[model samples]
Target chain A: MLSKNTVKFIKTLHQKKYRNLEQKFFVEGEKSVLELLNSDFEVELLLVTERFFEQHQKQLNHLRAELLIVTQKQLESVGQFQSNDSALAVAKMKSNQYFENTQEDLVIALDDVRDPGNLGTIIRIADWYGIKHLLFSSQTAEFYNPKVIQASMGSFTRVKFYYGDLKEIFKKWDCPIYGAYLGGSNIHQLNKPKPGILLMGNESNGISEELAGFVTNKITIPGFGSAESLNVAIATAILCDNFKRLAGE
Target chain B: MLSKNTVKFIKTLHQKKYRNLEQKFFVEGEKSVLELLNSDFEVELLLVTERFFEQHQKQLNHLRAELLIVTQKQLESVGQFQSNDSALAVAKMKSNQYFENTQEDLVIALDDVRDPGNLGTIIRIADWYGIKHLLFSSQTAEFYNPKVIQASMGSFTRVKFYYGDLKEIFKKWDCPIYGAYLGGSNIHQLNKPKPGILLMGNESNGISEELAGFVTNKITIPGFGSAESLNVAIATAILCDNFKRLAGE
Candidate 1:
């Protein structure tokens, strides 16, 4: 059974303002929803199709959240996915999260990554690289945006994002800053110091001029071809790979 | 001055059928349009606003293509972008083009990469890595799709795409095949041999079981954290970097 108010409220969560106000965000599809259920994120509501309920009743029997049987059509009305079969859960947002600066930990900070997809991909890259802490400028894409959540593909649950001004974080941080730049020394050649801030910049613009000044090392991925720039997410992944590879050595 | 027929025709180009049927594709926005103008691609029509014509008259004066002055409204109705400022070009498609595999060059092959954005990013990555030849399984996303073009960010002009069965290409190729996989050997320690196939797989299912048989070298971008998998494009970029780095040595 679906209530009109509940349906309307979930729709509002699709917007960032409603999500922030309610302190809740929706996780759609089975994989992400199941991951959410397994994680520390508190599930407030679970809506599953009849097929999904029948298949997962053993798992559902243990969860304490309010569960409702929903048709695919009903799921479409409340969220963006039109043919989601398994589940959609409204998960409580993690708040008051501060990335504790550790000198031995490698982390990434975004200057102004505006694309939700890029931010999400960055999160996944960070997770793959074992980078647990991600700090994004307030101007970066909202963490809870559905597009970002979808693109992260469940890595969002593992990676913690701390939103703050990069300038403030850099000023007080304990490690060296390696900002990605076009003119810097080749990243492949540089012996990247671990436990540093790998600061990436906006997609269209490189790191802001103000933030560039604070960077202790301006490093670049050497380009063999004529591409003007690598995509920010690609750049981040390569840099992370280099950092991790060097650490292993 | 968009004709009703022209508007209807441009709308059709948004779909693969119409694009194939007309043997043409639409390049949206000012930057891409300008790049198309400068490239070897033949422009069938250039739809530009009066403001754009006035600003780029020096650049536009020499073009042999038919030009029409259009309002931004005309562009939005006819193409995917909601508000394009400068120009849109209906460009002729390149046909019968094949990725020329060379014993002296590094190349990338895709198994079943489906997303337009992923394909676009891979093209950009290929361009950045100086991998001039790209082979894709027929199931891969088409290069001329507007989203792919937009996401490629003008790199479509530089990278050449060849669509075929991966099995066929691998059977006869002279070089070793390095396929990305989760269970593969650590990519860091291996001295990657040049002039080999760097094969990538589908976003979800990975390289199909049938195609996996052809891979000569199985490699992985090791994951230090809990991320189940990296986005295909990110994995591709990391692998390309490692290959390029080792080749340089």
Candidate 2:
């Protein structure tokens, strides 16, 4: 059974202000809940339907957090999704960590990536390409946004994200900065990729002029058809894949 | 002003059944509206705010449809998005037409891609890559789905799609069929990409075994990081980019 206060708290997580104020976010659905349980993230509470508790008794006992068994109707009341999952969890937000000045790895930087779904997809793409450090402009969507968390699937557990001023960070960096644009040099024709920062910009707007001026290499995916522009997330995946392929070769 | 019947009609278009019954779908936002107006698509009706009509009188006159100027509140009530656009249009759904049997060119076949957003992104990617034909399993999200239309951002105008049984289609096709899978041969290692169909499968469950058996070439996007899987749309973009790059070379 869920207390009235607990229900309010779970509901509060839907808003960015409340999520930040409480320093907690909710993970709904069985797949995300299971991933959270196995991740380094600290789980504050695990709420499950009575049937789920009975079915997964062995797994439930292994958890270090407080477990509460509630009726299906009760779970539905606190759940954000229309189809209530067997389990949901409240995870404490991890503090942002900056990496040491390293010169041997690729990193991704986003400039005002406003869409939560696009941001999440980009994180998942970064994870796929083995890019560990993701730096977002202060204007990027929050990492804990529920839509982002859901769109990322479970990649959030593996990818580290930091929200800060990208311009200041790039000014201090010695490695090359690659920015994707429409008429830039063809990505396929570029030399092998090295450890650098790959910058992606907003949905409607490409990289800001201020940041574009700082970029060492401007590249494009080379479109053949009449699309106005590729979706930012799709473009990110293509860029990351090309970078990895060239680096590996 | 929008009549009560007109409002009800637009609202009903949100559902697949009503859309199919009426043989029309809605496209909102200024860019998408303009794209449809310029395309070969038959525009049934155009709804615009008086401000938009006054602002773009020249362009509005080019549209060969009944244009109705409504108030902002009326547009908002009938609009799909919270932040409403200046114009919206109801486009007549055209029947899928297949060209005469000819040597296969590069095409894409989606197998039960349930997510409308993914389907839309894939269509946009197809348009960007200049792949003219996209085939979808009947189980795949409909091309006219509002979410799909929104994500495609009007690429639906350029890309032609056919809905049918993929298994039967694969059996009849004599050209190479590339199936994207986890442990398949690294796509970068494949020397040549013939004019063939690139099959992208469901999000959770990849290509069904029936379709998998018919795949002549199995390829993967070669992940280096800890992500369990790439989002279907991201994977499609990467695959399409690589395929076009190699084909062009």
Candidate 3:
């Protein structure tokens, strides 16, 4: 029994334009909503079904956000998930901040990786490999896109995103920048990888010409078959795994 | 313009039942259509815009399929792509056949990996790593799903799929079965990987309990962060990369 105005307000957060204007976004589904509640993010509202509320009364205790019991149909009507029987949250967006890389840090930077699903999967991959900060070119998909949020699973809570001019940011960094390319040195055979930014390109295009100029080392995951190229997210996971393994050794 | 019946027939192929009955599926987008034309699979129809026909006349030469000049709108209406200005092809599905693993072959098997997008991405990853054959449990997503065909990029033309009871198939194989798990031997530290079947599990569930018993080596991608687990496709790519790198070394 949600109000019409409340549903409209929740639906507006799905678009990037409205999300930016309000500096807020919504997270849907049970696991993501639970992660949102536990995260440091300031939750403004929690929309949940009676079943969900009853099952997690202990976790809902001391909750600061306003909670409203809604039907499963109501949750499905306004959220991105086709069936969200549990909860959804409206959370405040964090102010944009650039990562200050230390010598021991391995930063991941993207040059206009525009797909929301790819961005989300990369965030999950980053979280798995213990990467805290992700730098994105200005043209990359917005961090608050619901597709990115859902695709990221719960890792969005752990990983941070900073979007700006990649060229400007790379100019200020001193460590080696490993750019993924089709014809670079084989990643498996490279000498120990150092802590640096691992740059990935757009879905169709490789790294932009301007970004290419700043790459200190060019690397590739050798392909033994006929795939033109790996999906951006898939390639990112492979590269991150190799870097972490090489650096650890 | 495509006939109403032709359009209706093509749309039916989107579902598994119709695809199975007719033994055909449609491929959309420019790259995949071009790949389909070059592949060995028989093509029943080629719907192309005038511009596409004019540009690829040389490639279209000696084409045996029924060719029709259709508008982009017609293509979009009948296919899965939101915008496909180039071409679409209705191609015959290959007869289902299981792989006969040789001593040197490295097979990839999935236990109920049900998502079409995940299956497609895994196909692309398999192609990149030169994995020629993929084995799937009966519950896995159909190989002819349009999402799988599109997400696979052009690799669907290069890789083969076999679906059946995984338990029955594993009983006949003598090679080691490597099952991916959350807690297992570190993949990066494993002794040089031997040729074998690598088993990936469903999206939410890891390797099935029954399938776990058939595994000779349990392997895992060690995680350093708080994310629960990797996406099935991303994990497959990372595992395949490790295996190829280790075996090659």
Candidate 4:
């Protein structure tokens, strides 16, 4: 059972303004909730249906948060999901920003990736390629958005994302910045390009002119067919695949 | 100005049942409408705002459809778009299915890819890779769904899709069949693997068990990071990239 205020608060978290104010975001579905619990991120409150609670009895035993076993009907009222039969977790946002000196050799820099689904898929791609750090331009979609989190599956727990000014950040970067473009060096011809910052730009617009100056090498995934361009996330994965293939990371 | 009957008929096109019955579908946005007009697809009607009419007067001059210069407000009500400024096209569906012998070297076969967006992106991917034929399991989402068509971004005109039983289809396949899975040959290691059918399965449940026996080679994208699996469209793009790279077509 949930109080009126509790349900309202959960609903408000769906909006960026409220999420920023509370410094929290909601994670839904069985896999996402389980991942949130297992991750280092702090879980404030967890609402689950009996089915979910029963299935995860062993894991639920040691949870530190307030676990309210709610009816499926009650869970749906507060969740973005139309029919949630599993769980929804309200988790604290970790503020481990400014990781300028991270261990990961390759970093993906996104500039104005506005689509939530695209951003989420990119996160999943980053996780698959073992690229841990994601630097997003301020214009990019919010990483905490439910659609982005859902699209990322459980990979959101593994990928680290930071929203900041790419122009200033790239100006001081010490590594080679590879920018994806239309008429650049063919990705296949590269002699195993070095590990560096891979900059991806907007969906319709490629890298903005402001950050274009910082790109040391312009690379492109050669297209063999008639489609104008690849989706941002799809392009990102292909670039990551090529980069990882070369880096042998 | 749209008549009440025109508005009601356009509204019906939004539903798959009515779309199937009418044998017509909607194409929105400037690019998609322009593509539909240029393609061999028959245009039943074209609705455009004053701005679009003036801008594309040359193309509009040759169109055989019932062209209605609609107000932006009127266009919004008749189409799926909230505030479309350019154009919306009601295009006649082409029923050219029996292409068991297309000229395109590679074919994409989807098995129960239920998401409209995934199917649309796959169609776009197929177009990008120069793969013209898309074979779908009967359980796959309808290719003509507005979301799928919108997401495809006019690639639906170029790529050919067919829905049929895979088990019977694979029984008579005369080419190599590559199925994507968790454990399979590293995509990079394949020394220019032969092209046949690239079989992708459902979003959650991968290639069906029935079709697994027919797979000549199981292939996988090497993952350096921790993502459990790639999105169907993203995976399809990477695989197509590798296949085209090897086929050198």
**Which one wins on lDDT?**
3
- List the candidate numbers ranked by lDDT, top first: 3, 4, 1, 2
Candidate 4 chain B, run of 10 with poorest lDDT: B96-105
Angstrom error at residue A53, model 1: 2.5
Q: Model 1 TM-score?
A: 0.97
lDDT of 4 at B65: 92
- CAPRI class of candidate 2: high
- Model 4, B1-249: lDDT tens digits are 678998899899999999999999999999889888889999988899999999999998899999999988888888888869999888888783746744348889999999999999988888887788889899999988999998898899898777888888888778888999989999977887766899998999999889999999999999987788999999999998888777765
Q: What local distance difference test score does each model get?
A: 0.87, 0.86, 0.92, 0.88
Which regions of candidate 2 deviate over 4 angstroms? A50-59, B100-104
Using Cα atoms with residue i matched to residue i, what is each candidate's TM-score against the true structure? Answer: 0.97, 0.96, 0.98, 0.98
Task: State candidate 3's DockQ.
Answer: 0.94
For residues A158-177, write the lDDT of model 1, one tens digit per residue. 98778987898888886889
lDDT at residue A77 of model 3 (Cα atoms) = 92
lDDT of 4 by residue, A59-122 (tens): 9998999989899888888988887999999998988486783534789999999999999999
CA-RMSD of model 3: 1.2
Clashing pairs in 3: none
Q: Which 10-residue window in model 1 chain B sums to the lowest lDDT? A: B96-105
lDDT value, residue A152 of candidate 1: 86
Note each model's CA RMSD in angstroms: 1.5, 1.8, 1.2, 1.3
Off by over 4 Å in 3: none
